[model samples]
Target: MKYNRLLCAGIAVSLLWVSPCPILSNEQNTSYASPAPAKGRAYYEERGDIVWEVPTHRKLIALTFDDGPDVSNTPAILDLLRKYDAKATFFVVGSRVEKLPHLVKREREEGHEIGNHTFLHSSFQHISRNKALSELDQGQASIVQATGAGTHLFRPPGGSYNDSLVKLAKEKGLKIILWSWHQDTLDWRKPGVHRIANKVLRNARNGDIVLMHDFVHHSTQTVEALKIILPELKKRGYSFVTVSELLSNREKPDGLIEVNK
Candidate 1:
């Protein structure tokens, strides 16, 4: 997934700090999965990645939002999660953490997981291992400084990861998490709410991880889609969990363990 990195950086540099809130509220409306192989499932074939989806039968799935802590879209997304009683993992950027520290703390207090998404949201392909480590170090520092919590989860910006990046993250006591290819809502494209909803609901399965964002305005549509997805999936007997908790329940052994339970 090639990210609009230049665009993201521009937005970061130009925006001044604002209080976090839902997009539908005033204050300048703004913004902001999965595995399982059923027939016609969107099976992603990424080579050399660490963790994508947990291969399990626990009826658990993880919803992960990336490039966030945005003042515009984050709070509303948080509200929706609480409303649904759904827990998610937020992969937040470092500078965004500095801009909206309260939101990070709020996410922690609300029982959501926060992971390092890099200092400037640099793509893993563009950064060397050392640079990647530095990104996590500084990103985690900001998160800890703001929320009084530290994260062991590291997700490379733009879903671009490599062996060296994964190795360094593990050495730093971090886990590299990517999303289930079948469940990528591509909400960043602002594809309509129904499209996003259909894409996820039609394809998702147990032990999957979903990728989404909290930085675009149309992300409110992502929120709207979640309104439909949450109840529909709950009706289907699916349970929402954080990325770490999903991995914690993985059938474990050594590195990259397979399910055997």
Candidate 2:
């Protein structure tokens, strides 16, 4: 398997394009932290290690949708993803996942990633310590029970996170996944399809994590934007991947990280 490389890295990049709807890149992917990786809890105590982007030179991006597994919209979004042969990460709410276990399982079967978005979609950064931890615990349980896998990726609700939330997230063994401002589609606001598509492609770059919501009010606009966005990004030389695939610099697993199912 070929990996992606960063701009400053000395590794020779091998470009292999997988033909289909969206193209897949075989270039090596690596991260060069601005402040650098460190040891001890004090190290991850900062926000950088929480991982907002992959920091690679290869033209690869991860599409992450939050608060989903909805009966109506999730299937539509999944259809769009299938149409483009693209993979994405879904940060799902626990209760929603419980109510839509089949949808959650479908996401796993279809090769999309599932992440913990909290049981109640509460503000982990602002909630009380126990409450915040409880949210993560419950969310993890629901996901594992529903999909028979554990997610190491988590995204705070509404993107309202802080260093404290980082600590709690690490306690749960989850790596925080945030969105870059440049790639935020803002489809949650029901932005017009054209506007959402334009925003994502405007300043898109390598190692970007474009944020969209599958069930934010509804997913019609998001699904429509994807019809345009996926192929357009592919045309502009971008490959879609899951968050873990982007971070780990490898292909996504055949299924999720299954636990004792």
Top candidate on lDDT is: 1
lDDT by residue for model 2 over 10-77, one digit each (tens)?
A: 34332343456743232122111112223443354243456666666678899999988778889999
TM-score of every prediction relative to native: 0.76, 0.76
What TM-score, to 2 decimals, does candidate 1 have?
0.76
Candidate 1 overall Cα lDDT vs. reference? 0.78
> Tens-digit lDDT track for model 1 on 1-261?
236888887789878667786444431221111122222222222332357888776788899888888887898888988987889999999999999999999999999999998889876554444566678899999999989979988887776644445557768888777788899999989999999989889998888999988877545787788889888988898888998778777753354545421
Query: C-alpha displacement of 172 in model 1, angstroms?
Result: 1.2
RMSD (CA, angstroms), candidate 2: 18.5
Runs in model 2 deviating more than 4 A are: 1-48, 250-261
Where model 1 places Cα greater than 4 Å from the true spot, the runs are 1-49, 128-130, 217-219, 252-261
**Per-model C-alpha lDDT, please?**
0.78, 0.77
Would you give me the overall lDDT of model 2? 0.77
Tell me the lDDT of model 1 at 204. Answer: 86
